[model samples]
Target chain A: MEFFINRSYFLNKITNVSHAISPNSPNPSYSGILIFLHPDMIHLTAQDSTMAIVTEIHPGELNQLRIESTGHMIVDAKYLIEIIRHMGGKNIHVMTVGDNMIQVSDENSKFNLFTLELERFALPDIKRPENEIKISLKNIRTTVDQIAYATSEKDARTMLMGVNFRSDGKRIITAATDSYRMALNYIDGEFSQNFNVTVPVRALQEAARIFKNDDDIIQIFVNKRKIQFVSDRTLIQSTLYDGTFPDIAAVIPKNFKSMMELDASMIIPVIERGILFKDDGVAELRMNLSEKGIQIYSGASTIGNADQQVYEVFYQGEELRMAVNGEYLLQAIKALKTLGKVRIDFTGVITPFKVSDPENKDMTMLVVPMRSSY
Target chain B: MEFFINRSYFLNKITNVSHAISPNSPNPSYSGILIFLHPDMIHLTAQDSTMAIVTEIHPGELNQLRIESTGHMIVDAKYLIEIIRHMGGKNIHVMTVGDNMIQVSDENSKFNLFTLELERFALPDIKRPENEIKISLKNIRTTVDQIAYATSEKDARTMLMGVNFRSDGKRIITAATDSYRMALNYIDGEFSQNFNVTVPVRALQEAARIFKNDDDIIQIFVNKRKIQFVSDRTLIQSTLYDGTFPDIAAVIPKNFKSMMELDASMIIPVIERGILFKDDGVAELRMNLSEKGIQIYSGASTIGNADQQVYEVFYQGEELRMAVNGEYLLQAIKALKTLGKVRIDFTGVITPFKVSDPENKDMTMLVVPMRSSY
Candidate 1:
């Protein structure tokens, strides 16, 4: 393979594809990036067993890309990126020097990197699925960020480690639950057909990173085995989990014993301080509401105690007290801070409570209360 | 104890004192900060046996410091700082609420922190030594930064973990070494009495952090057992290590077979990239200097090889080749990058080479060449 390209432009492509490269991948082929140089374009591919990322660079887009020969080489991803990034020159020259070595050089530095044989490289099979759904990057990113945090980090329940995306020809609903809490987001979109798939939370986060602007629309192609998020120059494909997600929509209660509205800016800092006094192993916090306002308190036998009061909140229904996981509530409140104000509805001491933005009705966050010996 | 102070100002003082606190201290008294409130000023102190930092806040310095009642309290350093820093109000009100509890409150939050009994608190003894020497903060800080990196991290030779500061009533010489490499710095300062002390590198680092401006002069109070760095509002006292530093000045050879000069900006980046191909367990780099230029190269059997050449250099030495630890050379070169150009003197392939700024004769860095199979 021989090519001369702008150092910075090539470095950006390597970094985008490196997102999927796992250093500890057992297969030697998976540890390097496969660079394919065609007559008009260059494609960089990197993948682990479960996910793959491919980025393409065309000659017309960047006038600096000058192709000398059409060939392919799989170079160690880590070393390749480091050499390219640390080089001082504006352009880099890459050419095959020996049977299994390629020379990457700039004005001052030259690196001879060993390349993996093409016969051993495990190239990912990428195909555009027949069923494709188009959605704005802004809407999809919001949906993923709102619900992905609630996914289970533990592998006990493999399905819970992913966020469930289900569409019914009219609206797309996403839900994530780690048993203790659940986050759900609903968005209106036109769908080609009905589909439900659980994509790994980590994969969704990586795909969300490709959304740089609200104006760029992304096309997501899905099948029974894999789902791919396709952008203008990049594509991220992830495999699906093989279990059914729990039916959690039935649990969103319609009635509550008490509800309160709070300014997100006013309450987030108070909870952040109050949680510092939480018990050593448990983030248990007690919140009380009355006609005056809301009060939150937490105490650890060895670490002292903290109390914070917000007197500007608007409360209705009956005065209530509930024990909750402070970290969960804090995260939900922080995520909703962009909405300015949020409303929280509580049923009883033992039931789950719901929090939502008063201005937006599509996003809902639910948390189960912990038992307190008050 | 009851007092109200500006939250931001108090937080800054707490943070400064917290640098000396160790969380896993065996003595409970050393884990908390002792706050002493006198009629004129308030002093905050935190110590971990070996090092102590005391900062004083006077009423006039910060007009927000209002002494309602004069008393003292010992609170957990970590918790106290967190609560004070997270509070939203401009001014924080602190008052004793119970026998061993103090209520630290702002307009929105209240924290009842458990304080250690004053009797158990190990108040650091900070008495200015009789022998006092004044030095610019800039000079001392520069001396520490230049030599501290060469100090031994291993405890096998306890004295090598400290930097030796010796003065002959006219000039102060600082030297630090871990056997393989040594860094020496010389600065002129007037002294009332001749003194030689080896202070722990860790302690010196903490003391150096207090030097914010070049114009500020710091007083060093030294005695047989302890050394203290005093500024206007803060004082850092550390116990002197009980051992004698080696006389390394005799080891710096004045004779050299070859010498070369290179631009710091040009060669530092080359070495940084060449070291990427270093051996797995060793940062071994090979350098060749001749009439052509300076060429550096390194290789690992499994990670490939890299070569970097610096053409813009003035050489006065015969053809020479040597192998040295890349990381050590890189660090010394990086530290001297501020000096535009650096001169390197090589005695032989196996002898210790020296690196220094051609303009500044006071600072010198020497590294031993490693044995390598060509």
Candidate 2:
């Protein structure tokens, strides 16, 4: 392929796709980026069997593109990235010289890199799937941001490693849990058919990064084995984990006798303070309510302990003392945007506790309490 | 011990000494900070055998300190730092109760931490050495900053892991090298006696961190096994390496046939661009000089290559081609201030290259060329 592209534009496009290229790919071709120069645009594609990313750059601006020929080649992603980084300018000249060599040069420096035949690379099937879901980019991103962190990273239990996306015609629900703490986000959306699928947390994260325009709609094609997220000029395809996700909704408590309402930001600092004393592999949060205020305390045996500044809150039922993971509580509180208050629901010492923004009832975070000896 | 101190003051003092506390100390006492509350001031000390730092805070500031008693104890450094960080206020109340328990509390919360007995912790002896050398803090910091990066971190070659500080009654010289490259800095100072000692790089780094006031004089007490640096309210003691430092002055080239001058900042970017291609371990500097101007071309095989924008230079040689470690060149250039011009002296391909800022002749960096096949 013979083409001249803007150095910055080419660098930006290459970087977007290079994140999917693993250095230790089992397949040598996967370690390279597939570069295709068509009549109008240059397409860069990289994948590591799990997540694939493709970005197309138009060569219309600044007379950035001069295509004399159309061809395809897989060039070493790492080397090409470094070359473009050092080239340093708006415009760069790239062309195919020998049968298996790509030449990238600027005014002062030139590099001739060996390339693999395009036929050797495993290109994913790009045909649109039969079952497609259209959703607003902002809604999907917000849902993912709110719940993705709760997914388990360890694959010992393969199902917990993915976030469950459930839709039932009227509403779309996203739930993630690692058995200890679960996050559920409910958003308004319409689905013609009920669907339940588990997408790996990493795939969701990559999709979130590639989908930047909030106003644009993201088209998701889901099948039995693969899921594809498409935006304006970018497409990310990932293989779904073939495992049954646990019923996270069943674990969320539906009733509570004691409820306290306090500001999320104010409560977050208290939880963070409690985390300071967490050592010996355990983090505990102790909450006590009195006529003065709500007091939060956290302590670890081997490390030190912390007591947080109390905030005035309205409490009902008997005064309670519950212990839970400080980190989980902190993460949940940080996700809440409106600083007004969070309603904390407690159901005795052994039951899971629920925390939700009082202003928004659609989002809920549940954390299972630690077995404290006290 | 009971006292109330400003949170910001205490935090800053603790942070300065926290770097000396070893996270993986075999002795638990080493992981804790030694607190000594005297009549007039409170002192915090932490040591890990390799290096020890002591900082003091005085009472009577913003009604923050209210001393009730004077005592000493050792509290966990990590936990204390985190507690203070999360405590969130200008003032913090700290007190010791019973034998080995410390309490740090604020307006709405209290944290009671278990502290180690002061007798169990080892505090380095800070007695003034008979053959101590006093140097201007500003001079020492400048010298250390210039040469410390060259010191080897690996203890396999113990001597190379320390910077050699040599004194000759009138001038103090500091030299550090990792065999491949060496940095030497000389500062004019009056010393009562001639001395030569190899101080560990860690000690130099600690000294640089604690010695903030340039006009303040830092007294250096050097014994057979330890080197002590003392400022007004801080004392940093470090163990000296027990190996002979090589005579690095012999490696510096005495004369040169070719020289080129260019701005340090201008050349730094060029080296940064060249470093992107430095993964293959070789950096090539192809210099072409004529009446027109001077240009530098550096490239690495694994990273990309870069051609630097030409700069007007006073050159006194034919076209020169040499390959040196890009890191060495970058470090030397960064050491130069806004008086940005750097002078490069070349002897031959086999000899070491010397780089220095024309404005400051006291500092010089020498880098050995790597044999390149290209």
Candidate 3:
């Protein structure tokens, strides 16, 4: 392979692809980035055990590329990125030398890196049909943010570590749960077919990051064994798990004994202060609602006890009190901060409760209360 | 004990004193901050096994303190800081309620924290004499920055972990070394006594952080067992090490066979880039100096090799080459970056070399060469 390209432009491409390459992979070739030089563009591929990222860089007004010969090589991802990032030159010259080595040089520095054989690097085949669905980047990003945090980080159950995506020709519903709490987001769109799939939360997060600076919409194709996202110059593919997601509709509470409406900005600070003694989110906090006002309090016998009151709250029905995870409540409230006010419903002390944004009615968060001695 | 003070002003005092308290201390009382409420001011003290920091907050223009009674109590430093940091009120009210507990409340929140008995909290007695030397805060801060990085972190040689401060009734000299490299700084000041003491590098770092916004001059008192620093509203005391510091005069070379002068801005980037393949500073790089110019290069058999050259250099001697730690050379060069052009002297291939700032004659850094197989 032989090529001359802009130094900074090459660095940007390698950094994005390096995120998918795991440094601890058992196979040495999995840790290398596959580089293929063509007459018009250069293609790069990096992968881990279950995911692969491929991107192409073409000659444009801002990017300079000149290809002398067409060839391919696999270089170590970590070393290549480090060398390119620190080289102090505007243009870089790259050419394959003898004895399985490549020469990379700028104006003042030269690096000769050992490369692996092309036959050792293998990428799984992915099918990209022409009938793939096009979804707005904003909708996909919102779905990931609204549901990814609820996925389980504990590896006891592999099914809970993914977010379920379901479409019924008119609307798309995404839900995530780790048995204690569930987050659901509803996005309305047009589609030709109905489907349901569970994607790993990490894959969704990577897709969201890649779309942060892209165009308005992208194409998504889902199969029985894999899923792919196609943009202008990049394609991301990930393997899907074979399991059924839990039924979220049946678990959501239908009615509540009491409901309160208040601005999210008022109670956030109280909860933040009350959790200082919450023992790193392991301790439970009691939330009290009554004719007097709203109060949140937690205590540790050896450390301290904190009690805080919210000044204004609109209430109806009977007063109720329940113990909930302090950290989960804070996250649920902060997610609805964009809306002016939020509504919280209580069914019982041991039953699940719901928090909803008044303006964004398509989204709701359900949190299960913890049993408390108080 | 009872008092009402400004929340922000109270937080600043505890934050400064908390630096001396270690979270992993075996003694429970040592992890707590001592609070003594007086008629005129509130004094706070925190300490570990080797150092103690005591600071006072008075009723000044910016700070408002109202004391109802004079008493003392010790509370966990971590919990107190967290409560005060998140409270949403201008003035905080603190009072002892009952049963070894104190109630801290603002307008919206209240906290009851358990406290340790007054008799269990012990602070070592430090001596302060009438005859003491005064040093500028700027001088102390600069000295800490220049020498602290060279202190040894290994526990095998406890004496090398402290920086030696020596005085001759007119100037104070500070030096630190880890057996491989040494850094020395000389501060000229008016003094009335001569003394030498080795203080832990951690203590100096804490003192520098405390004086970041204090007055210009502070008094320093040294004795057989401890050293004390006194300002208008604070006093810092630290224990002295028993062993003597290493003699730096014997290691610094007096004559050199080769010398080179170059702008520090010209070579910093080259070294920074060359260290990319240096395996986190374990690998050594070769520096070639001659009438031709200056060049630095390093290589790993399995990875790659990097070679870079300096743009302009003024040399005086025969051609020579030596291997040295890349990280140490980079640090020594960066220390003199503010003085513009720097002069470097080499005695031989394996002998110690010196990097000095031409504008600042009182500071010098010496680094020893490593024996390489190249």
Candidate 4:
């Protein structure tokens, strides 16, 4: 394709689309980015088979965009990005050099990169025919961001590695769990039809990056095997998980024997310091409740132990001692970053404890307590 | 040992000392930092067997440093640093909790770290006698910085991996080479004794870090087997390279057939962009001189080539063309960062070429030209 466009605008859009290309795709062409130059707009697409991202560039938005020739080609994503990154000057021209070769040039440097056969590259069939759920990009991002961390990256049960999206014509719930911990978030959205789809956590994370703006409206379209998230100029389609997500209400404890409301400012740093004295590989911090407050400690045989007393907590019921992975606790606390107070509910020692923000009832985190000797 | 000191001050001094603690040290105690609480001051030492660093913490610098028990203890460097880093509030107290146990506590957190046996830790014997080369830390750092990049990290020729320092009671010369290229820098300093010593590149780099101030005086003491770089509050001694360094003056061309004076700002980015289109593995950039300025190009078989015209270069003599690794050229340019203009001198097509800053006559670079198939 032959096109002359603003160097910076073209570079940013290309970079965002290039992230979808899998680094180690067996099919060489699948690791390439498809660039299509139309009369009105430029279309860029990259897919790793599982997740695909497409960004549209309108010629009017750029400093100078002129389509000398209209065509399509698939080029190596990494090589194209590198060439543009180093090619200096304010304005750059990208055009077809020869058969299956593209030249990107500025004032100082002209870089010619060989392209893969366009016909060999198979892009995912991504489309949004009719939307089942219509949600603001801001709400979608918040729901995904709060629960994405709880999803397991490399679980044998593939369903646990994805974020579950469940809608019932009115309210939409997104939940992610890895057996050890679970995070659930609720978003108010209008859904015309009932839908349940599990999008891979990585795909959601990558797709959210495209929705950097808050005012963008996103339409969610679901089929039997794929789900498409389409904004104004960006569309991302991800393969759906075949298996069902774990029921969140079933795992959460119905009744808690004791509960502690802790200040976010007080508990975060205490656990941070206590976690420093944690054992290798497994970071376990024990929360011991006394009449005074909560005494948190991390123990080891050779590295000694760290014990800190947290003052700002309202504890009731009998004295309790529970242990959980320090990293899990820190993540949950950080995920609910804007919360003024964090409420932690404990049910016995081995039972899972739930952490939630008092201000935001929509977000909840359940962490399975580790087996403690003390 | 027991002492109460400012948390940040202790952290900074310990972190500096911990750099000398090499991981997987054969002697377990060697991996631990020895904290000695003397009656007047605190001493910290860490040794990797090859290199040892000793830093003194004067009592006057701390808010309150009292030695209740004047003794020494060896504690794991990484663990001790981590504990102090997270311990909240200021004015921390470090004391021997029990036998072979150290307790560091602040207002919020109390960390107990188990210590190695004090008797087993053996520190390096480093001392400075009457007369030696005493150079300003700034000058030493400048000389090392200019030539240090030329040293090979894993050269079979061991001496090529170290920076050679030579003095003739007038000017101190520092040179490093890896057979492919060489960098030499001269510093004007008065030396009482004529000496020559080759210090390992890693040691010079580590020693340079301890000299954070330009005014700090660096005293160089050399024995047959060890070279000690003693700065204020910090003493770092490293084993000497037993091999002889190559003569840098011998490789530098005495006469030149053609020369080009290139602007640092203009030439650096042009070569950077040209190098992006370089051939696989080795980056070779050809410098072609025509009646019009200088043309730099980097080529590849399938990826095409990048050719850029630089107009700010002043050319002389016959039209000459030579090839050199782009990475080597970039490193020499970056190391002499203060120079506004860089001059390139060439003797022939395949002979060694020199790049020197026109403003700084003390620094010189020698690059062996590649056999160009131009």
Fraction of the reference Cα-Cα interface contacts (below 8 Å) that each candidate reproduces: 0.85, 0.56, 0.91, 0.82
The most accurate candidate by lDDT is: 1
Query: lDDT for every model?
Result: 0.84, 0.77, 0.81, 0.81
Q: Per-residue lDDT for A1-374 in model 1, tens only?
A: 79999889889888888889877988888888999999988999999999999989888656499889989989888889998888899888999987899999887678898887677777898887766877778877776667888888886779899988888557888888998888888876656898888988767777777547776778889988898988978999889987888867768889999898988888888888878886766767898888789888899887688888889898888898888999999877776646488899988888999989989798888989988885
Candidates sorted by TM-score, best first = 3, 4, 1, 2
**Which residue pairs clash in candidate 2?**
A7-A90, B277-B303, B277-B304
Candidate 4 chain B: worst 10 consecutive residues by lDDT?
B60-69
lDDT of 3 by residue, A20-117 (tens): 78779888988889889988999999999889888999988666888889898999999998888888889899999886988899877788899976
Model 3 interface RMSD, one decimal = 1.1
The better candidate by DockQ, 1 or 2, is 1
Q: How accurate locally is residue A14 in candidate 1, as Cα lDDT from 0 to 100?
A: 88
lDDT by residue (B1-374, candidate 2, tens digit) is: 88888898788788888889878988889888888889878888899978889887776554466677898889988878888887767788899867778999888888889997566686777676767777787877776677888888795879788888897556888898898878888876666878889988777777777777877778888877888888867888888888778777766888886888877756665667666655546555665554456666665454344565464576777556666677777876776554568898888765788888888787888888767653
Pick the DockQ winner: 3
lDDT of 2 by residue, A217-294 (tens): 888888778888888688888777777777666677777878887777677777777777666766777766654577
lDDT string, candidate 3, B274-325, tens digits: 7776655475788889967888888777888888877589889867889988
The residue ranges of model 3 lying beyond 4 angstroms of the native Cα positions read: A129-131, A188-190, A249-251, A279-281, A337-339, B129-131, B249-251, B279-281, B337-339
Better of 2 and 4 by TM-score: 4
lDDT of 4 by residue, A307-333 (tens): 787776798877888888999988888
Q: RMSD per prediction, one decimal?
A: 2.2, 3.2, 2.1, 2.2
